[model samples]
Each structure stands twice: as structure tokens, then as C-alpha cells.
Target: MKRINEQKGFTLTEILIVLVVAGILLSLILPNVLQAIERGNVTAHQSNLNTINVALFMCYTQERDWTQCADITDLTDGNFLEEVPENPFGGGYDIEDSPDVAAGDINAGKVACSTVEVTVGGDTLPGTCSGA
Candidate 1:
């Protein structure tokens, strides 16, 4: 008498196919996930810029002139800011006295600060700032 055998597991070819499909799906999904994360980073950087701008404006209001805040770190006034906001891309902010642009010109109205040029994963994107 002969006994019948039952199939209880996937074959090697079937397993390979599943793996390839999973890999393809992951490849398609990973870029979008990464892009979303990058966008979030950019948003955070923008928020930081806004915070700094507000603080600078407050400082100007109190002083009646633009403060020579050379960098974000120079903002030590507790009422203004605890410290300088760092560049989300990994560098410090670049503060300068703008005497040309409206609302940013130190001599005209306000002091303007900008982010240092940053590169993300070899791609150069515009940084978060008033002009940028």
C-alpha cells in the first residue's frame, strides 16, 4: 500500500517570489517616506526661523533699533530667547545686518537673520529664511 503526501510549506520559488515582491514594494515606499521626513525637517526649520524673527523683533522694539545680534547664540535675553536657534541642517544660523531689504534692513527698520547654506544628502535646497 502507498501513503499519500500532503504539501505543508511553500516551495523555494514561491518564497523567492514573495521576497522579490516585498522588496519591490519597499523600494517604492521608501522614497516617499524619506521625502516626507525631509519635508518635516524643512517645516521645523521654518518654525525655528519664525521664532527667531519674533525674538529679533521684540528685541528691536525694546531697544528702538536693531540689535547687533551677530548670531543666534547672541540672543541671551530670557525675554527674547534662551539661545540661538540652530540650523536644522546641522549648522549654526548666519545673522547679518541688512540695510537694504524692507523689514530686514538694520538701518531701515529691522534686523534680518538667515540660515547658513546647507546640503541635505548631496542635494542643495533653499534654506529657511525671510528671503529663502
Candidate 2:
């Protein structure tokens, strides 16, 4: 009589158990990973806002006012900034001068010239350079 060798492999129940365990582990870890990504976006958005603040302040130093500029492109065009940094969260930066101050005034109605507002993740996260 010839002896037969039994080939060992993962049974269906064992495979199912492994898959279930894997799914459980993934479910536990995925939320943390998503949270980390969101936090990263917030940090990046804040940093971008701060960078915009610096550029805007530099523009103020040169022009003595913040009224002439309305957007990030103005900073680049005026050479106050080398390049406009992109918003990390997907929203664009808008320069909001003090509405009370008329255009061409020294203050140009700028209550806060060096502050930049940023909204990220479809406005899920909103922040300012001052806050950052």
C-alpha cells in the first residue's frame, strides 16, 4: 500500500476568520487615518493663511495701503510676493479691506491687514492667519 501525503492549506472557515479579523482591524484603523488627514489639511491651510498674511503685510509696506489689492494675484503682479501660495483646502484667498475705510485711503479700511482667512474642505474647516 502506497502512503498518501495530505496537502495542507487554509480551510474555508480559516480563510473566513482571517478575512473577518482583517476587516475588524481595518475598521478600527480607518477612522484614525481619516482624522489624521483632516488635521493635516487644517494645519496646511493655517500655514498657507499665515504665508498670505506675510505677503499682504509686505504689500502694505510698499504701497502704504491694502486697498489696491483684492486677490492673491495682485500680490504676485505687484511683486510684493514671489508667488501666491495655493490654499491647501481648495478655497482661494480673498483680501477683505475694512469696509468702513474708503478705497485709496492710507488705512484703506483695513482693520487687519496682516490677517488672512482660509476655509478648507468645502468650508468644513475655517481659520485665519491670526488664529494660526
Candidate 3:
């Protein structure tokens, strides 16, 4: 049987093929996009940590004692940093010293973003920071 003036449109197989290709492309690209976003977050996290470290340096120069400044508030209160910067994953950066960690460790004297660890080679260290 034949129909007159049949509409011209994509067949089911063609539509499905197009959808499959789109899905494949999306699958290939989505992870890369997500990874790039995470990388940006990691970079921002490092920048924030560096900022806090600079503030810590200022605190150390003024107080002349690491024990004197053991919290982010110590930096903020002392006018070293205008405000506290939160970790990218959430929560605030920590200032750790003393008996909790041994000397020469990253978090020992000064380490920010204690939650986010970055592994370079075999060493796993927290995200370093930079501040204004």
C-alpha cells in the first residue's frame, strides 16, 4: 500500500542514531568538564591557602612565636587578613601546631586547607595558600 503526500522527516533509526551520538559525545566530554571544574577549585583552594600563609608569616613576624597565632582569627583579628577564607569543599582552614603534629610537617608549623590534600609525586600535602 502507498500513501499520498507522505511527510518527510527523520526515520526512527536516524533519530536514535543522532541521540546515541550525542550521548556518546556527552559521555566523552562530561568527565573532562567536571575535572576541569575540580581543577579550578583546587587552584582556588591553593590560592586561598597561600593567602592565609602570608598572613601567618605576618603574624609570626609580629608575634615572634608560632604558638601566639594558632587560629585564622588570630590573623584576621591582627589585621593580617580582612576575613577568613573557607575551603573549597567546605569548612574553614585550620591552623595547626604543637603536639598535634611533629616539626617540619606541612600542618605542623603552618598549613592551611588541612582537609584538601594534594599529592605531588609520593608526597601528599595540603593545598598551599596566597593572600592580599
Candidate 4:
């Protein structure tokens, strides 16, 4: 009796080669995607900080005074802010009355701004929101 010789499925070596290729492709693609996501998060964080700063600045304008803001609630309670934006990295958003630099102080300088900070990936990044 004559038997037909036909490949029924992929060989073990072929499967391993395909897996290796897939792994290489994934290795090349994953980092860029992750980086893009991280950049997006950072941008969103900055936008939120800017929004908070603007609201605080407007509040200061309404009060016609320059005071350090410790909490975002003051803006909300005063109706300057409808709500506080949530941090993307599961860290609390902080507002400081003074900036890290002498030039960033709203009270001292013409800059109407605040020092905002948040922790991202266990790293604390500070940003300044200025009225100018």
C-alpha cells in the first residue's frame, strides 16, 4: 500500500521560529507604545496643573489678593473651580503658595501662579502655573 506524504501541521522548529519572530516584534513595539502612553499621562498631568493654576489665579483675582493656596477645595468652595482633576498616577495633587524659585512667587512678582506637584511612577514632578 502506498502512503501519501503531506505536511499536516507546522514542525516544532517552525513553531519556535515563529514564536521568536513574534517575540522580537513585540520587544520592538512595546517600548514605543509604553512611552507614548507615559508621555500622554505627563501631558494630561500638565494640563490639569495648568487648569488648577488658572482657577487659583482667578480666585486670587476675585479676592484681589495673592495668597498661597494649600488646598484645591478653596477654589471649588469659592466657585472658582467646579472640581479638581484626578491624578493619573494615583498620587494626590498638591498646591503650594510659593514656588521653588524666587521668581515664581505670585505675591513677590507680577506672576500670578502657583506651585503644583504630583507623584508619577513614584517620582515627584513639580510644575508651575503662572498667570502670565
Superposing all C-alpha atoms, what RMSD in Å does each candidate have to the true structure?
Answer: 5.3, 4.2, 7.6, 4.6
What pairs collide in candidate 3?
A: 49-129, 50-128, 50-129, 50-130, 51-129, 51-130, 51-131
Deviation in angstroms for 30 in model 3?
A: 1.4
Clashes of each: 2, 1, 7, 1
Worst 10 residues of 1 by lDDT: 109-118
Candidate 4 C-alpha lDDT tens digits along 34-75:
999999988887888789878877987787655534477888
lDDT of each: 0.66, 0.69, 0.73, 0.73
Among all windows of 10 consecutive residues in model 3, the one with the lowest summed lDDT is 112-121
Clashes of 4: 1
In model 1, where do residues sit more than 4 Å from their true spots?
Answer: 1-8, 99-132
Number of the top TM-score candidate: 2
lDDT of 1 by residue, 1-132 (tens): 766886689999999999999999999999999999889889988888788778776776776555545455556643688777766677655556433444435446343544444444566565555632
Candidate 2 — which residues are off by over 4 angstroms?
1-5, 104-132
Tens-digit lDDT string for candidate 3 (1-132): 899989989999999999999999999999999999999988988899789889988997898766667787899999999999867766667676545444345425464423334443445565444431
| Residue 54, candidate 4: alpha-carbon lDDT | 88
